[model samples]
Target: MATTVRRTSITLPAARLGPENPLPALRTPADPHQVDERERVRFPPGMARRIGYAPLRSLLPVRRLDGYDRHRTPTDLEAIVIENDRLRATVLPGLGGRVYSLVHKSTGRELLYRNPVVQPANFGLANAWFSGGIEWNIGATGHTTLSCAPVHAARVPAPDGGEMLRLWEWERLRDLPFQVDLWLPEAAEFLLVGVRIRNPHQRAAPVYWWSGIAVPESPDTRVIAPADEAWHFGHERSLRRVPVPEWQGADRTYPLRGERAADYFYEVPDAARKWITALDGEGHGLVQTSTDLLRGRKLFLWGNGPAGQRWQRWLTEPGTDGYIEIQAGLARTQLEHIRLEATSELCWLEAYGPLAADPAAVHGTDWTAARDAVSRGLEAALPRSDVERAYQAWLGCADTEPKEILATGSGWGALEVLHGRFDLPGTPFDEATLGEEQRPWVELLHNGRLPQGPLSTPPGPTLVAPHWRDLLETAPADALAEYHLGVAQWHAGDRAQAVRSWERSLKTAESCWVMRCLAVADVESGHPKRAAERYLRAFELAAEDPGQAHAVLAGLAREAVPALLAAARAGDAGALLGALPVSVRERGRFRLMGAQVLLAQGEVREARAVFDAGFEVDDLGEGEETLSDTWFAIAERLVAGAGPVTESIRRRARAEHPLPDAYNFGL
Candidate 1:
C-alpha cells in the first residue's frame, strides 16, 4: 500500500534485478572417517577411558547463507521509499531493511553513502556483512549476523496524520524480537526512527544495539558531536583516553592519507536532547538527535592509505570511495553491552535529517552555542512540535497498548514522563507463582543475597545447594537449573559432582556460562590443557565487544594463572605454553606473567622477547606507576645479560609512564 499526504509519498514496490549466486559454505579439511565417535557426542557423560578427548563438532555438513541474495541486478527486489517535500529516503526491506539512500530535494545532495552495488563482505561474525546504507546492528558484535538478511516490513497509517514504514525481525541467536518504524511527516524535514526491543525468554541475556549510519568520507569532512573525551581503541583490546576530535596533539576528526585507522566511542553528556553531526566543508550533511534513551555516539573511519583503500575495494567496489560510520548506541558506548532483563521491553526515539550550517559553527567546541544554533535552524525549517507529534503518532502506531504520556505532548517530555514512571526496571522472579520444589532455587538465583565469587559468604551456598539439587533431579532438561546446581555444588566443595553437573548442563544446552564454569573446574582439577581449550571455546561463544571480551578473558586468565605460573616455574615450558588461553597475546597481564616466569627460569633471551610484548596501555590504568616499577626492574635484569634493551622497549615503556626519569634508572 502507498499513501500520499500533501507533498509526501510512502510507496512499497518490487523491482527486478539479476540471477542470485550465494557464497560458498566454509568447511574444515578433516575427513569424515577421521572423526572420533566420542568427540561426535554433543556432551560426553563423564571422564572416560581415553586419556585425550577431542572437542565436539557440528553434525551438519554444510551451513546456510545469511539470507536470500537480492543484490543481483536483474533479480526482483522489494523496496520502500518515504519522501517529503525536501527529502527522499529509500529503504531495502528485503535486504535487512537497510536505509539504502537519503537525498535532499532542494540541492539534490545524497545525505547517505549509497553503494553503487549491493556488495556483501565477510566482516561480521556470520561471515556476511553488507557495505553502505544504514544497518540496524543488534545482538552480538560487528554488523549483525543478519545484516544481509530480510525483515518483515509494512506500510501503515500514522496515528496523527502521515504514513509510517515499519520493519521487524526475530533475531536468530536468542530469539529476541526488534521492531523499527520510520516516519516522515508532510511538513517536517526530518525522518523519525522509533525502535522497540523485547526479551521474550524467562532468562536474562546481554543485548546490544547500534544504528550504523554510513556517509561518504572526504578530506574536509568532520564528525561533530557534543563530547569532550573518548575511549580510544588501544593495543591488546584496551581503551585509552584522549580528547574528542583531537587526541595526543593530533587532529583525528579527518584523517590524512597514510594515517592510522580511527575508531572511537564517546560517552554523550546526559541531556534532554543530544546530537551528532557529520558534514562536509560545503555546510551540507546529516544530523542525528536522540532523547536520553540513546546516549552513545561513535565515529569510525578506515584511513585513506593503501591498506584502507584496498579494504574499501574489498568491502565494496573499486570505484567506491572510503566511508566513515556515525553510530548511535543505546548504552554509554558501543563497548558497554546492556543487560536486558527477562520478559522486558526497551524502546527509544531517534531522528535524522539534512542540516545546513556554517562550517565554523558546526565544528565549534561550544556545544551549547552550536546546539542552540542548530535547534533554532531546525525549528525554523520544520517546527519541533511537528516532529514531536510525529513521534507520538509513531508510538501509537507501533505498539498495540501504547504508553500514556502525562507530560507536555513533546517527544522529550513524553520520554521524561515515561522514564520517571517506569525507571525501566528489571523483572524479578515472582516466588509466589513458582512450584514448591523450585521456589528456593529460584529465590536464590533472583535475590541478590547470595555471594557469587571467592569472596562470597559460605552459609548462602550451603543453604541453597539442596534446593538446586532437587530442582535438577526433577528438571533434567533445564540448562539454567543444571548450571546453578553446579555452582552450588562447587561452592559446597563437591568438585567432582560440580563437573558432572556442568557437563550435564552442556548436554542440555551449549551456553558460554556453562563452558566458563567447566573451564574453571578443569583448572582446579589440575587439567590446564582442557581448561585452556574450554576457555577458548567460551571466548568464541562470547562474540562480545572488545572491552567485555577482555574483561571476561582477564577473569578466566586470572583463574588459570596459578596453574600457568606453577608449570612455568617447574620448567615445563611446553605445559606452560599449552596452558595459555587462545589469543593470550591480546592480554597484558598474561604477557607480563609469561615474561616473569621465563626470567625466573633464566631464559634471558626468551624473557626479553616476552617482555617486549608490551602490556595494554589502558588495562593498567591506575596501577601504571606500579607496572612501570616492575618494567624497570625487568629491564635492569635484562640489561645485565647478553641482549641489550632495545629502543622499542624504552619507547613502549615511556608511552605508558611518561615520567622524566623512567628510562634514566641505573642498571
Candidate 2:
C-alpha cells in the first residue's frame, strides 16, 4: 500500500526573545500544558544554550511546599533574598557550631538549611545585597556547615523538547581558605564550584568532613574508581568486596541474586586517574570525584563499616542503576586480609562531581612507590603464608581425620594456630548419612574439625549453631540446651536477645556451655560502651574458670576497636571512650577521642593537652600503633595543615619498635 506525499513551505513571523514571546512553531509548544506532565517543554535561546553550552539537563523545579518531590516550573524556583541582616548571626558553641536563620519566599515548601555554623536567612524574590541562597540540610538532623552558600541559577533551554533545562552560574563561598572561587557554570554542561571555611572560634577547628552529592538514579550512571586493588572483610559466611561490583555484570558472586542493596567500601591509590565515570547508556551521564580531579588532588577515603564479620555473599546486584558508591578506605579484600595501618595508607578516593574532562589533563601525583611499600608492609604483617605452611605440615604428619582433629586441638601451640586459620572446605553431613558407628565422626565434624572420608563433610550443625537458634528454641534441653538456645537467638538475628540469653546461661549449672555462648554473643552484640564492662565481668566470672575468658577476650579484641570507631563516627563519645581498657595505653585512645570532641567543641588548647597527656601513656598492645597514626595525622593537620601525613606517620611508627600485635585483632 503506497501513499502519495506532498511538501509545502510555511513561514512564521519572528518575535522578540522574552518571557512573553519565545520562538515560533520551530520551537516547542510555548504553552506548558501542551506537554505531558512527565514530558518537559522547551523554548528558544535557553534551549540553544542548554544544547550548545550546557549538555546536562536540570531536574524539573518544584516548590518546597510540594514536599520532597522534584521541582517543576520557573515560578517554583527560589533564591534566598535576605530580609534582615541583624536577625541572622553565627554562634560558636563547643560542639560543631550552630547557624540560626529565618526568611520568606514565594515557594510554598519550608526550607530547612543547616550547617556547623553560618546560617542564612531567606528572603522572597527581592533583589538584595544580603541575599542568602538556598539552605542545605545535612545529616539525619538538619545541621549543616555554612561554608558554602549556593545561590542563583541561569536556566538554559532544553534541546530535546524535555522539561529539564541547564543551569549555569559562578559561585563563591567562605569555607575554603586557600582555594579560589570554583568555576562551576550554571549551564547543565558546566559546574564550577568554590568552597568556604569560616572558623569563628579563637582556636583552630578540625572540621569533621565528608562530601555528599545526590544525583538521581538513571540507566546512564556507571560507577568507576581509579584503583589498583580492592578488598573487603568477612561478614558472617559472606565474602565482601570493597570495590562493589567490579564490572557491570559480576552478580554471580553475590549472595542474594537480584537483590539490589549495593553497599561496600573501596580504596583508590592512583591519583593519575582523575574522575570515575558514571555513563548513561543514553549519552547523558555523571562523572564524580572531579573536585579533586579539577585540583589534581588525591581523594581521601575514610569510613566505618563491617570488618572481620563474615556474611554469605559480598555485593548486591541492581539490574539498572540503583546506586553506585565509592569510598576512601580499605577495600573488602584488603580489609579482610590486611591490617588497616599497613594496607589502608595507600588509598585515594573520589565521589560525585561531573564527567567532562581529559584524564591526561587532570593533575596527579604518582603514589605507586608508596603504594608498593604499603602492600609489602601489609603482606609482611599477615599470617596467611605462615598459616598455610603450618596446615601443610600438619597434613604431612597426620593422614587420618579423627587422629588429626584430636591431635590438633590437643597439640602444640604452633599447630593449634595453624589449625585455626586453615579449615578444610566441604559440605556438612546430612543426618540421614550418619549411622550409629559414625556418631563420633559426626561429632568431630560438628565441632569444626576436618573429617576423613570420600565424603569429607564438615558438619554445619556444630559450626553454625548460632545461625539456627530459632529452629531449636522449642527443642528439649540436654548438655547443649542453654548453649543451643543462645546460638539460636544469635542465628535468628536477635543480637540483644542472644546476649541476654547467653548471660542467663552463665547462671546455669553448666558453666562451661554458658561461657562459650556468652563469649560469642558478647562480641556480636555488645555495645562499645558496654564492651569493657562485660569483658571485665566475663573475665571475673571466669577467673577461677579460664575457658570463658579466652573465648570472650578473643572476641572482644577482634570486635572492640571497630565498634569504637563506629560509635565515634555516630557521635557517641561515651561509647568511644568507654570501650578502652583502664590501662594507660588504652587511655591514649580515650584521651584522643576526648580531644576530637574538644576540637569539635572548639577547645583547641584543651584538646591538644588531652592528646599530649594521653600520648605519654604506656603501650598496652601493638593495637595502639594504628591509633598513633591517627593521632599523628590529626596533629599534623592541625599544625601543618592537611597534606601528606601518611609518610610522616609511617616514618614515626616505624621509628618505634615492635608494632602492636598483642591484641591480635584481625580487623
Candidate 3:
C-alpha cells in the first residue's frame, strides 16, 4: 500500500516581528486596565477585569492592536514540502502545522491562498490569527486555540499509494486529540486530507471541526453546488427555490462586491458527495468535496468595500490579494452544536485541488450542469474510475448496512411517536382494529408534531398541551408520553403539574430530560439544594444520550449560577463546587469562577487547585460575545498569581492550555 515517499526542506525569508518591527509597538496592557466600556456592560461585575481587552490602536488603512504581528525583518524560516508528480504541498510545523502552500504542477497555480507574509490580526479568540492556507480548527471554535502553536508533524507512507504529511495535536480545551493526514498520490490531481478526531475523556463533550480553504477571489468567481437551501450563518434558514444561489436580494453565486458585510452559508447536500467549488472566469478553480462523513459545506465571503477591503489588508501582505474561504465541517452547519460520545472516534475524508473547464459551461445555478462540468474537469486531470475508486475506498461504504425500522421500546421510538405517521400500509393496527384503550396512544402516534417544511416560528405550548395530556391519561405506563406532558405543562405555566408529571415519568423510566425538568422546577421554587441534586443526577444520565444531556447541562449551568454564587459567599467553596453537576464543573469557565471566588476568600491553595483543574477541559460557554473576555482575564490572573508554578507550567497554562481567542471572534 505504500507509495513513493520523499521529503525536502525549503527556507523562506519570513518577517520576524518584535519591538524592533516596523509595525506599531506590541503592548500587553495590564489585565485590570484593558477594559472596553461596551464589554463592561455585558460581562458580570469583576468579570470585565478578569477578561481584559485588546486595545484598538491604529484604525485607518490597517488596524494595529494587541495580538501576534508579522512585520519584522527577514529571517530564514524552514518549511517541509511533500510532493508527487502532479501537486506539491508545504507544511509549516512552526506555525500551527498548517499547509502553508499547495500548488498544481501543471498550471503552476497555488491550490490554496499563500499569504506572502505571516501577518497576525486581532480577530481570533486568542487575539491572534494568520490568514491563508488550510487551517484545521478543532475544539472551541474559530481557527482553534492551537492555530498558531507548533504541532507534531512527520512524513509517512499513505494507506493507498503516496506520502502523507501527518499533523496532530492534543486539544486541551475539550481534552480531545485531533490529527490530519495530507496525501498527494502520484499522477493524481487531487490531494486527500484524512482527518481523525477522538474523545479521550470518560464523558461526552461538545466538539466541532472546520477546514478553511482560502482561494483567489475575483469578479468571475462563482460557487457551484447542488443545494436548494442554505443555513445563513449556519443559524438562519434561507430557502431559495428558483436560482438557489440568490439570497434575499443578492446573488451569492457570483463574486461579492460593494458591501461591508460577511456571509456564512451551508449548502443542503443532496448526494453522497457534498461539494462546493469557487471557479474563476478562466475555469481554473479549487473544488472541495467530501463524502457523507463530512456533513457540512460552507461558503464564506467578505464583501468588497472600504471596511471589507481594510480587513482584507489587515490580515494579509500588500501584494497578496484578498481571498474567499470554502469550508467543510463534520456537523450540519457551523453553528449547529454536536457532541462526541465518551471515548468515541470520528473519521472522515476530504479532497481539494485544481479544476479546469470552460467558464461558460460551469457558470450557472443549475446544479446538474454545474456538477457535470466539475466532473469533466476532474476527469481531465486523472482517470475518472481511479478517482472514484479511491474515494469509495476512503468512504468505506462496504461495511455499512441499510438502516432498519426502530424497535417499539427503544428511547428513539418515543421521538417517533411524536413525528411518525401510522397510516402506512405496514401498520400493525388500523382504526377499526384498535381497542378503546389504545385509541389515544394510536392517535398521538399518528398525529404529526409539526407540519412538513421549516416552521416560521416555534409553536406555543397551548397548541400541543391538551393532546399530550390526553395521551398521558391513556398511556399511564409510557414514560415518554408522561415526559412530553411535563414539557407541555411547564411551557403552559403549570409548574406544579409539570414537576408532578416529570416525577411520575421518572418512576417508569429514568431519563436526563425528566431530571432536567425537575431541576428547573426546583430552581424556580427556590429549592437550590434539590435543584443541584437533580442537576447532578441528570449529568450522570448524560452518558446514555449526549445530545439531550448537553442540552440539559446548558440549562442547568445557566440556572445554577446564582446558587453557586450564594454558596461561595457563605464561605463554602467546596459546597459550591460540589453542588455543580460533573459536566458543569468540568468546564473551564465554571471552574474559573469557582477558583476566583476561592481566591477572594483567601483560600489560595484551593483556588490554585481549581485553576489547575480548569485547564483540563475546554469549555466554550453559552456564547463568545459574553465569555471571551472572561476567559482571557482568568488566564491572565492564573499566570500572575497561580503561586509558585514552574516556568514550563506557566507557559503551558498560558499558551497551550487556555482556550484560544479565535472561538470568540469567529471567521
TM-score of 1: 0.54
Q: Each candidate's TM vs. the true structure?
A: 0.54, 0.23, 0.51
lDDT string, candidate 2, 221-265, tens digits: 333345543333222223223333433454211222223223333
Query: Model 1: which residue pairs collide?
Result: 17-73, 17-74, 17-75, 18-72, 18-73, 18-74, 18-75
Q: By summed lDDT, which 10 consecutive residues of candidate 3 come out lowest?
A: 454-463
622 Cα displacement, candidate 1 (Å) = 31
The local distance difference test score of each candidate is 0.56, 0.27, 0.55
Q: Across residues 549-648, which tens digit of lDDT does each residue of candidate 1 receive?
A: 3334444444444454544433543334444446644445556656655666667567666545544321222112434555554655555455555776
In angstroms, give how far residue 92 of model 1 lies from its true place: 1.7
Give the Å shift of residue 161 in candidate 3. Answer: 4.8
Query: Better model by TM-score, 2 or 3?
Result: 3
What ordering of candidates by TM-score runs from best to worst? 1, 3, 2
